[model samples]
Target: MNAPEAVNETDAALLAHAQRLTAQAGRPAPKALTRLAGGRNNQVYRLEADDGPLVLKRYFTDARDSRDRLGAEWSFISHAWSRGIRAVPEPLACDRAEQAGLYSFIEGRKLTAAELTPGHVEAAIEFVLAVNARPRPALAPGSEACFSLAEHIATVERRVARLATLDSEVPHVAEARQLVSAQLQPTWAAVKAGILSGASAEGLALDAAISADQNCLSPSDFGFHNALIDDAGKLTFLDFEYAGRDDPAKLVSDFFCQPEVPVPLAVHEHFIERLTQGLGLDAASVARCRLLLDAYQIKWTCIILNDFLPLGAARRAFADTGAWAERCAAQLAKAEAKLELVGADDTP
Candidate 1:
């Protein structure tokens, strides 16, 4: 079931390191290596062993936005597993020195919209709620949430400003500039003031308004986009490099915000109704979720333009195909749609 593939010195070293660590964990050394797809921040491969199938992830540091990638992932998942959450890949071994980790491979396919049945949608909602039910896990020493509300509007506003620093003459940059300055900045000032006057840095005054817990730990990116489902219909989630304690509002808003895998409004309605009534969340929390969603919507608008950056273009090998502008323009279009969609949604 393994494919024959070639790897160079860097990957060879990573595989050798994983072998030693897996052996230390009482697992067999990897006998074959086949690079798998669907990763933006790591080199993911199928490591064939006597047990036969496992996943090996090597952090891509050159262009990644996260810090302490391996440490944060290891700590976050370990804490999640310890909390009785279910259906995630089991960690087999981790080597921080090499910035690599091994996990048990799940036999499943990533579910696209066509393959995502109603049952799958229901299960996905349940899984997110369960994650929220668990206590927040500690961030790795040097790690933090992408947009935890504790940092408030100032944090993401600074990131938006950074996107303009390059002043690159790229179409993606032009579109992003238009969106962030013409639209996001003008709207954000008012929203920020409204939110600040309403609550403290911690978050909305949910405690005073309702008995519900404010925000639960998030996988940073929440969606079925990073998940798989087996023949038996079980869901196995993946990707936690950005996982940590996060703002509750971002959690709710991001569930259906991804550009690649869009969620239906009916599904959103079901998810919102369940979380609100089931968790006993108050209106204050709803307002906060809406506020953060507005900010994250703009944040993602800028992120789509990241691939046009100098280092990012090189890391993704855009020069090899020479379609960097095409890709950036496409991402810009997606960002525009995302802005319109989030702006139109009046839920809360």
Candidate 2:
């Protein structure tokens, strides 16, 4: 990623937008606006003001994918704040017209896989439980939230189908095409079959949706990947763009399946039991999580290869100005590694 062009903290339009939002929030104009990295779908910056530090974020907008990222994140954080959840940022101000929002800056570093400890895992579990302690009407279902096994399978199938459309002569694209056709497609077929068959064996209906009470507030892309450890050793979760009501099973699956800052599989059982027991989830929900792990694993493989798609490439380009061929090749390798985790039999 090229910081000069990609972030461009000096960009007049962005600075103007930030100034407007900060002024509206009753703060001194930022003496310095520094762009922050780690955001893949939006622009984030740290603003230093006379009072303190604040964060300004510009949500990504595209005709092809419109999910109201700004609204979702603002509403989710507001809800958590209202419930006395301090593990999230304070929602300070928003400029919907600018597709931007301002929040309390978090001084922290992204948690890495190597630094993960059981205490950290417990903190994450507690955070989820606290967030879901009660429900509110303001929140909507999470982006692409699936209620049934059939819906989950359909979502993955659609992603795989999109990847199958790759038909280019470029070296990286050509290699991706072969991987999709030979590995991804066949792996998805097997995973789909296994999920359907396993659901039947477990007496879980593929089309039947779980009751509303079973739904939990999910940080859609939940994982250590989205968490930061502050200077004081408190963990603060970020990126609620896809946060809202979702199947707890899906949340659990994504927690373990997310590749970045991967949570250790050794804690999988403890994590599941603690979350289920705390949230009062039924045994069937636990079974669903276990049975659906492979499906999610396959889904993540398709997600990792998104660099080959038009919209995916566009998002990547916006976030990181890397060479296309290099990124595509790296993503293909990641997808292959993720695919290998599908049947490693570590499902919780």
Candidate 3:
């Protein structure tokens, strides 16, 4: 679908406002401008100013907490940069009042479904492995807690429960409830068991603990569409709106969730190998991480079935209830296959 039209703001007005903000930061206004890709959620544009080629990202709605969002993004991009991850754009300035920001625009093609071939997956995997190598910095003093898969599960459960109570005749609502009920329990059990058995639980005592320590930051929305690849084949990650502290397994699950890319079992194995090697994780830990990845993938699939897919053509495409159930069943079957392999290898 095409992006919603952005509000008409004149170049002169935007430039003047941008100039004032840049001046405050000891920089100059952009010399030229061009509208970039606009998405359903945000308006992105390119600013060719005296300073250099920069990007302007403007929010279409005020529902978001722009201040905290920008702060989190800035922290993530800066931290990832320091750790030698070349998957982020450089943030130059932010104006929370205007709900806009300026950043260094990397030259590259926006990765599409077709472009995410085997080679692209390998490169993207390496980039993420590098980014997840270090611990995420503490959220800014007053910022919100970083996003979490466990928290997301809780939210989905609540939403699904609410949907169940609503009138049963609502299209896909009943099917959504059935899907969540059938899938959530076993999936969450696998994740919990994996975490408890892994080395990451030695110090953490929480019932739903995914990691003993939250050391890595994950782009909660990591996908091919959010990646930009340059001529040199280097990938740069963008869209930090959902960036937050998370377990590495969740990040891997996010990558595998891309509908266009069929991530084979070998891809998963290679990803874990690279990740653990890069992060210096032990073999046992990697095994446990594999199980957790499977669990997270199931949970993520349930989320898509319940929320985004229920209201649109996704429902018809998958067939109302039976097809949706089959999809979840298929995911669980694949997950079980992977888990079986993990279990077999872990056997003494």
Candidate 4:
């Protein structure tokens, strides 16, 4: 299928713009241009440069604040490169004024649902392990991860409370409110207990803890979909919009939650093993990381239900709020089981 039309600007116009920008930088005009197929947050295009190929990312400028995220993306990709993490595309240049940037286009096959096989799972785990091995890069003086566990939990609690108050107006609001209220308190309690008990201390000791890493560089979003496999079958990761110093456990948690795979307990164990091997983490530290991962997953699920599910845009999906609640409950139960297993292990 032909790529979607460039939404913000016509292709001819964007091509002309790219030509001007490249010429200004003393580079030749691109040979070909085509829109890329992922991401709802940014406009991406593949530009075939004279030397080879480069990916052009134009930041959404409709909102004043939306344009500001480019700087963070630049900081992340550059820092990751310095630390030898290949999880990010090689950023070439960023023009904040133009609200656009360029990076090397990794040549690989985009991962689809069918590709989420056992072999692919092993590959994905290895890639994440390599990323986690590196120390998280320090955030710029005042920069922070988008959210923290404490803050996130508070937001969920507040939203759930608001839903409770709106129950009479919305049809399923009461059910969602109850579903959220029932779990909010215990989930928050578990998070607090985990934090106070130092269950998440090892990889989360920095200022932002898992939210922001001190020396470790993390991709803002790491999932099977964002990863690609080259002809050689090696994994090449892309997308750095959410890349920053985050809790290693959070990264693992996001991976486990990816829709592309069914996260069985064995898969989690394999991830820990490969991650430790790739990142040079000790066994004890890996076990500790696993606990933090379970905690982070539960925290994320709560955010999805209490926040996203209640929003007008997402309410339709919760038409059967009872069903949604059951699924969330099931996932939580699994997470709890994993937590118990990892928490009881004496290795870490």
Candidate 5:
């Protein structure tokens, strides 16, 4: 694990960055750096140093939206540890200029969907409940008190629209472009109608708003794919770059969305039940989840749809064929089925 990473120009730059971080924190320079895998938004490395193992995450400069994602994550993890919560990686040194931070690596073998058991889901449920028990005001980006489902939907719509702007270099890109275009509107309408129905029945106006009480600070990319299981039989959640006060419903939905972690339907039910029970959710929360199912389903449709976009193809780093294409085809059907799940023209 201490093997030195090859010093490419990028690696050399990271070395300098790491040196600065270590010197600033009064620690020895790292002995080696190992680039980690599977990040689409950030470059991560495991650094071996005299002080022990530290993880460095460098933010992506080309993120679609301009915001201090790095700063927000630092706030989330730092505050969590400040309050004695350590299921997350302990935040260490960071340099805002480099958009990189070091953390104490909670050593563990990252788990895959194949290894997912009810026990793992139970542990994950317990961890999230505790993590969300407190409100992290520092992590909030704006005056908003909670995550906005309407805003999320709007963003997804915009991204789907942007797909048209990307040149269709691959066959999947063209197919996905057509699919998303054909379905996004109807899907969104169904979702909105459901919410309206839920609200109208309760004699309230349809509101796409969720309060912090109904949400929590979430590691937005949370899933078994982003978590690890240590030898001690403990699970650790990873990837907080997208972490912030978010709709709890979104959190659970994202967890189940990852293709790499295939959570069974039974496990999904148990996790949801335990989470709802743990949160002591009221009627509003329950209703919110129901309405949110539409958005989450739509979100996943948008997510897998990305593999068809030019940028998505580039990020996927593979040609749109064979297994990848098959995966896309499956996702396309699944996404379309979402609309059917709610029924056509069916008012929410």
Candidate 6:
């Protein structure tokens, strides 16, 4: 990450631009700005103003990456706020051309894994229910949203294929190559076969898309990792760059499968029961979710190795996340840990 620098010519120009954008949003101009850390796909800054604080996000864009991140987040937050879902950051303003967005700053500490609790999970579940409540608005599918089981498997395959192409000998490249070729490839094949078998037993087509009602207005990367615990103990969720219409089953799986802020296995059953019941999901959908749990476990394992890919590493570099070798080694360990859990058949 770049160190805080004195206001040089470049800094002055960027700060002025931020202030201009804030003023356009009908918010007070920021008197000062500080670059915030922990962002992995964009540049985030804390903009200080007399009225209060706001967050300025300059999203990462590339010719290879075509997802409209700004549009997805702005639309998702706006719709949720319109529906009286105040558990998320308020969408203040955005400049599509600039790929920048300003949002109400949330004053709270990000939750640690140990800080995760049943209440937090319940609140998250409620947020999901509220977002998907009746009178839903029309929106695009989430970033890489998978409606069918086949799509989910195919997504993992594509990710693994990318990792499979890594031929470098730098840092953890050899370990990642071994994991992908020896472990990930075979594991994915087994997972795909298992998911297909489960789908057949449930009488669901592998490629059949779920009905719209069964779809969710998902905060695609939903979990405590994307949440902050305010002084009032309110869990304010953040980062909806990938949020939009998605499979509720995928949401449920992701909530548990995410490595950071690990939700205990004990809470898994309760979460599944509550979420499935609250969403009014039919038995088949619930069954499908059970089958997809292991599938998503593998998907997340692929996600952990994103740093090994060129575009993925580029995104991390854009966010100023340093220590690439350390991060790659650590991510490989985490991916291996997930593989253990996936093999255990522990989670329902």
Q: Best-fitting candidate, measured by lDDT? A: 6
Which wins on TM-score, candidate 4 or candidate 6? 6
Question: What tens-digit string does per-residue lDDT give for candidate 6 at 1-348?
Answer: 123323232478778888888878888888888887788899888877989878889999989999999999999999999998899898888889989998998878878888777788889989998988888888999988988877888887888778777637346898888888888888888988988888888998888888877887889988988988878898889899998888888898898899988887677778778878778887767887788888888889989988887788779879877777888889999999988778454444
Q: State the lDDT at 221 in candidate 6.
A: 84
Scored by lDDT, model 3 comes in at: 0.56
Regions of candidate 4 where Cα sits further than 4 Å from its true position: 1-13, 24-26, 48-53, 61-68, 80-87, 117-137, 140-215, 260-264, 276-288, 292-295, 298-348
Off by over 4 Å in 6: 1-10, 167-170, 345-348
Task: Give a tens-digit lDDT track for model 3, residues 1-348.
Answer: 112234344668877766665666566677655565424245676766675667777643333224355656666777777787656887777887777777777888766654556787777677766666645466442222223434534543443354334334434455445544665455555655665565354433333444445335666666776777778888777877667666566566666654433354446677767777676654434544564554445444544443333332333332222344455545444433433332233221
What is the C-alpha local distance difference test score of each model?
A: 0.65, 0.83, 0.56, 0.55, 0.65, 0.84
Question: Residue 60 CA error for candidate 3 (Å)?
Answer: 6.4
Question: Compared to the true structure, candidate 3 yields what TM-score?
Answer: 0.64
For 161-231, candidate 1 gives per-residue lDDT tens digits of: 76655447555676667766776566667656656666665455423422225545667677787787788
Native-to-model Cα distance after best TM-score fit, residue 84 in candidate 5, in Å? 2.4
lDDT of 6 at 130: 90
lDDT of 2 at 25: 83
Worst 10 residues of 3 by lDDT: 339-348
Locate the minimum summed-lDDT window of 10 residues in model 6: 1-10
* Deviation of model 3 at 45, angstroms: 2.2
Off by over 4 Å in 1: 1-11, 62-66, 114-118, 132-150, 167-213, 277-282, 314-323, 346-348
Ordering by lDDT: 6, 2, 5, 1, 3, 4
